[model samples]
Target chain A: MVALEFWFEFASTYSYPAAARIQAMADQAGLTVVWQPFLLGPIFQRQGWHDSPFNLYPVQGRYMWRDLERICAALNIPLRRPSVFPRNSVLAARVACAFAAEPWLPDFVRQVFHANFAEDLDITKPDIIQTCLERSGISGHRIIERALAPDNKDALRLQVERAVALGIFGAPSFLAADELFWGNDRLEQAIAWCKVPSLVGIA
Target chain B: MVALEFWFEFASTYSYPAAARIQAMADQAGLTVVWQPFLLGPIFQRQGWHDSPFNLYPVQGRYMWRDLERICAALNIPLRRPSVFPRNSVLAARVACAFAAEPWLPDFVRQVFHANFAEDLDITKPDIIQTCLERSGISGHRIIERALAPDNKDALRLQVERAVALGIFGAPSFLAADELFWGNDRLEQAIAWCKVPSLVGIA
Candidate 1:
């Protein structure tokens, strides 16, 4: 089975749906899912944006919320409007980064997305992410400690760099055989590309 | 047959594919295709943007080209990189607005998109738009004269304002019973929404 890299940002509005349903979709297609958690702040900063593009453009931001509401409802996923747009996701990414190699990382990532988007909880706070870690059946205290460690912080930073190197400007990006697909809407297409790399004429 | 309003801008990159395929797809789905040609320049101005968002954000701009290449390839559509990022579309839009009530409007719109994207022609030029109009079997000279009339110019302006009133922030947007779906990727979903509006819980 070809390995598909699922590059996501904890604060991405679209990533919530992709993170919620990607694993099962990948499993059914007999593809190896590599869960990659990264932050978009650095990437946005590199693009000279101090905040989310949605915030910068009010019209686009308004449309995005309505679109997200309809999409979540269609997917039968619970989504509460977050109080903050693009919440500080450094901590959440670090935790996921600390456990990227573990089998439970996907579940933990989904839990974080759910807690933030479904519950409207602030993910920047340590306790909220701690709760997500616990719900995923992982040691919350040990993982949080490891996640906040200097080494883990550096690891997470490099992960963002990797996303940049791969030309991922937005979240819920999928990398299949070196071809990049951005946005949650492209998830199925990405999986299809993984299933048959030649179909897209990607050499 | 249900009517699906295809709201597009000549300057919009994604609108190329949507315009090219929308009529045939809608005909197959037994839906009426309403070709709405509006300008995105005023819409972008209202959003405090003077240029395309893709150009404003370089990384996104770069990814857009690559993504467009793959997408056009997958759809078997010929695409040439336009020398200009977003050619001025006011002239072309006015022409569209002038003859929108005519039956051959959709074909003319598709021809214009093909000229801009596939042939890399400058659509802002009267001669080029004239060529598209001739290809669609319309009187190029007469229509061009009517299109540049002051009333037709104002008509195009009001069309843009109507787009803003409808809360449309991007091109290639579909309006089915007032529910908006943005992006070419959502074209089929928009058609589905039109076919079964109640299933999406849109009242």
Candidate 2:
């Protein structure tokens, strides 16, 4: 079976919606999904952006908020803008790197996205990250401390670099073999592509 | 029956997809779709943008092309990037505006969008626009001449201004009563919203 890779950033609001639903949708479509957590900050920095492109474009930002509201409402998901415009997702990405191979990685990633967008929490702060981990019955302190280890940090950076090399510049990017599908809106097409027989050999 | 307003720009790629399927989809959902053609160039100029936001952002532009490819493929539609983007859709918009009350306005708009994107035609040029119109069995020369009339130009400008007033900053915006859904992806939600009794009052 061809497994699709989903690259997401915890701080991305649209990624939140996609991460919350992709697993079930993929399962229904008879596809395997591999969740990959990466930091968009480094990628954006390389592009000479200090902030999200949406934030840089006021018109886009406004339209994005409204567009998200309607999309969330339709999906029956609760979403609120984060208090911090762009939360420090470094810690979250680090933890994600450590948990990347774990069975709970998808759940953990979903919680982080939900906390950052729906609960409007500052995901960058250790306290909030710990709280989220604890609520999920995981050792927040131990996992977080391990995530800060040199090897783990290196792993996270490598993931970001890999994304850049793969021509990825945005979050919630899906990879079906060699084809990269960027943005949450393309999630459906990404899943459908995985179902095609032609994609099996490519992966 | 509540009427859902579909505000589309001729140069919009995704609008082509939505415009092609929206009427049938709305019919299945038991809602009415009103096609409103407007020029995004005027709106962008008013907002101080010299080009489409996708073109201004390189990463976005690259992703848009890939995303459009995936989307069009999924929908079994052929799409090719136009050579001259941000095509002076002024003439097309004028023709669309003049035919706003026509029963075939939706199909006409879809053909124009397909011509611009799928056929890779310079929709801004009168000859190309005329060819598309002629193929659609409409009087290309007559429509083009009438569309450029003083009154039609003023109407198109007013339509653009109205879009801004309605808080729309993008193409393929859908309005179901007072609620607005932006982007071609939101067409389903827009149709669903039109079915709600409470929203019907706003219409």
Candidate 3:
């Protein structure tokens, strides 16, 4: 089975819906899904945006919240507007990065997303990260300690650089053999590209 | 049965595919489609973008082109990269705005999109606009004169303000009542919103 890279930012609303279903889709398509968590903060800073684009552009922001609600409804996923928009996702990203190879990594990723989007928890807090890690079957503060290790932090930084190199400008981007597809809507297309790449002329 | 307002910009690459398909979708659903031509230039300018966001962000721009190619290929639509990133669309927009109520408006719209995206013709050229209009069965330069009238130009300006008031920040946006759905991907959701507004909990 060909591998499909799922690039997501924990703070991104669309990535929530994406995370909820990508595993099933990958399993069905006989493809391996590699979940890569990255920070949108660095990328946005490069674009001169100090905040989420939703906050930077209020009209789009309002539309996004509404759009997200509708999408979550359609997908049968529970969602709530967190009091804090784009809660600090560094710790969440670091956890995912540190445990990228663990079989339970996707489970942890979803819990982090749920904590931020559904439970409205601050993902930056160590307790929240620990809870998510524990829910995925990992216990104690050691996991969080490993997640905060300098090497793991550096790995995530390099991953964001790799994402930029691959021309990713948005969250929930999918990469099927170097070809990038942006947005939650493109998940199907990316999967298709991985399953039947020749049809898209993707060599 | 209901009205779907399709907001488009001739210079927007994504709008090309959108213009090609929206009419057919509207027809099949027994809906009225109101074709709206607005300048993204003015809107983007307000956002401090002097050029197409695609031009300002080349990484995204590259992904967009490849994605567009795949989309066009999927739909069996022909496309060529225009020499100009975003040709001055005012003339084409004025023509669309001038003939908004015409039954052939959608036809003219598709032709203009095909001219720019498929034929790689400069849509801002009078000859090109005239050609598109003529192909849609309206002959002669008289229509062009009417399209260039002062009131018609003002009407187009008013229409753009209406679009902004409606919270449209990009092209290929659909408005089902007060609900704004952005992008070609959202077309189906917008239609569903119009058809079954109840399921979405949209009032």
Candidate 4:
């Protein structure tokens, strides 16, 4: 079976739809997904961007929200526009990294995405992150405590560095071996590439 | 039949593929294609960007070139990397706008794209644009002369302003009624939206 890394940012609007469908879609293609959660804030800072590109360019931002609305509707996913353009996702990302090895990590990611994009809840709040964790059948308090550990914090930071080293500027990005495919629309293309070993020269 | 406006910039890499396939695809889908040629340089300048976003962000830039390579190969289209990151497309765009009402405008647009991206020719040169025009079976010198006319120059400028008024920040964008879909990947979705009359409330 081919293994693919799904690099996602909790604050990314497009990542919501990708996180919701990737696991099930990967399973059907007989691909194994290594869910890698990282922070996009540090990455954006390196690129000299203080805010999301959607917010920095007003017209593009306007188009993105409408595009996201249409896409979510087509996917049968309910969307509730968040009051904030990009909610602080540090806590959510850290907790995600804390439970990176857990089998239910994907579930946790999806729920957190839902909390931010569908429920219009603040993802930065510990209470909200915990609620997302608990809803995913994980021990919210325990994981949140572990996630706040210095080592886990360092681990999350390292993950962000890894994303930068891999030349990823956006989420959700897919990596089949060393090849990177960005955007929610590229998800199917990434899967197709993974399934066809020749595409990645794996065969 | 439903109608869609295809807003494109000559220097846009993604627009090359869209321009090559849009007319045929629209025809097969029983939709009318309104080719809107405009310059993205002015639009980018308004957002404080003096260059392509692909160039403004290095990592994204690298990924885009690689992504375009793969996409073109998948589509079985020839791609020649231009010596310049973005060749001045002013001349090509003006010529396209000049022939906007002509029956062979789509063919002329495709040839210009073919010249710039596929053939690595400078689209800014009148000789090159003229060549593209002649190859499309249109009068090269006459069209080139008309394209450089003062009135045609103002017409192209007006089109760029019109694009901004329509909330278009990139190309190639598809507009079905009031709905805007950006990117080549959204082509089929835009077509589908146009085909389903109820989606546009025409039914």
Q: Give the per-residue lDDT of model 2 (tens digit) for B114-194.
A: 889889888878988888777777778888898999998899889988888888878799998788888777776677777
Rank by lDDT, highest first: 3, 1, 4, 2
lDDT score, candidate 2, position A183: 78
What is candidate 3's lDDT per residue for A44-80, written digit by digit as tens?
9998889999999988899999898988888888898
**C-alpha lDDT score of every prediction, in listed order:** 0.88, 0.81, 0.90, 0.88
lDDT of 3 by residue, B1-203 (tens): 69998999999999998998888888898888888899899999998889998999888888889888988988779999998988999999999998888988889999999999999998988999999999999983988899899999999999989989999999889998778899988998888788877445532
* Tens-digit lDDT string for candidate 1 (A1-203): 78999999999999999988898999998999998999888888887789998998877898888878878988889999999888999999998898999988888999999998999998999999989988998768888898999988999888988898998989989999898899998898788889777545532
Model 4 clash pairs are none
lDDT tens readout by residue for model 2, A122-149: 8888998898787767878889989999
> Candidate 2 clashing pairs?
none
Supply DockQ values for each candidate: 0.46, 0.25, 0.48, 0.44
Candidate 2, after superposition: displacement of residue B155 in Å?
1.6
State the weakest 10-residue window (summed lDDT) of model 1 chain B.
B194-203
DockQ of 2: 0.25
Summarize candidate 1's per-residue lDDT along B8-51 as a digit string, tens digits.
Answer: 99888999988878988998989998888898888788767799
Using DockQ, give the best candidate's number: 3
DockQ of 3: 0.48
Candidate 2: list runs displaced more than 4 Å: A197-203, B45-48, B197-203
